[model samples]
Target: MNTINSILFIIFFLGIIGTIINRIHLLSLLLCLELLLVSLFINITIWSNSYDTLISLNYSIILLTFSACEASAGLTLLVSLSRTHKTDLLIKLNLLQT
Candidate 1:
């Protein structure tokens, strides 16, 4: 269980790094975000199981709900942006006035 938790943490860290290094596609960014969220959920579950508590489980449930909403919102935004711009590249989304 400890090993699994460590692996999950590593995966979460890697996801963060990937998100930072990747600035090309919106989809990839969203996927990385989801990966981070999943890692968090897994960690929460593992701790809850280790401690035999309900609080962490409740928090995990809340996190899951928030992640779902985030994913949906991200997808909606991506779809709208793609429809308007016809591209999902992050570099092409320049709305700042210059």
Candidate 2:
């Protein structure tokens, strides 16, 4: 059962990497980030089960919250950018004002 869970976890982790590589929608990118967060959370929990320590799980939870905050802030900024310019394309965005 643990092996099965590990395999599933790995698959989802890779899926996030794949989605990022494909440069999908912004929302999809955020979803992939959340998926990665979950994968890490599960990994830390599984490690806690084996190592009998709570530190790893605690760290994972903290990082997950940080990632959530990052996603929210990034998306909010993206929304503001899109509203100002009416576009979400990175190539067209003057993010550096150059």
**Top candidate, metric TM-score:** 1
Model 1 ranges off by over 4 Å: none
Worst 10 residues of 2 by lDDT: 22-31
Off by over 4 Å in 2: none
lDDT of 2 at 53: 91
Write candidate 2's Cα lDDT for 1-98 as tens digits. 57957786887768677675746355566667777777776777777778889788788789778878988887997798779878766557656885
TM-scores for the candidates:
0.94, 0.73
**What TM-score does candidate 1 get on C-alpha atoms?**
0.94
lDDT of model number 2: 0.74
RMSD of 1: 1.4
In model 1, what is the error at residue 16, expressed in angstroms? 0.5
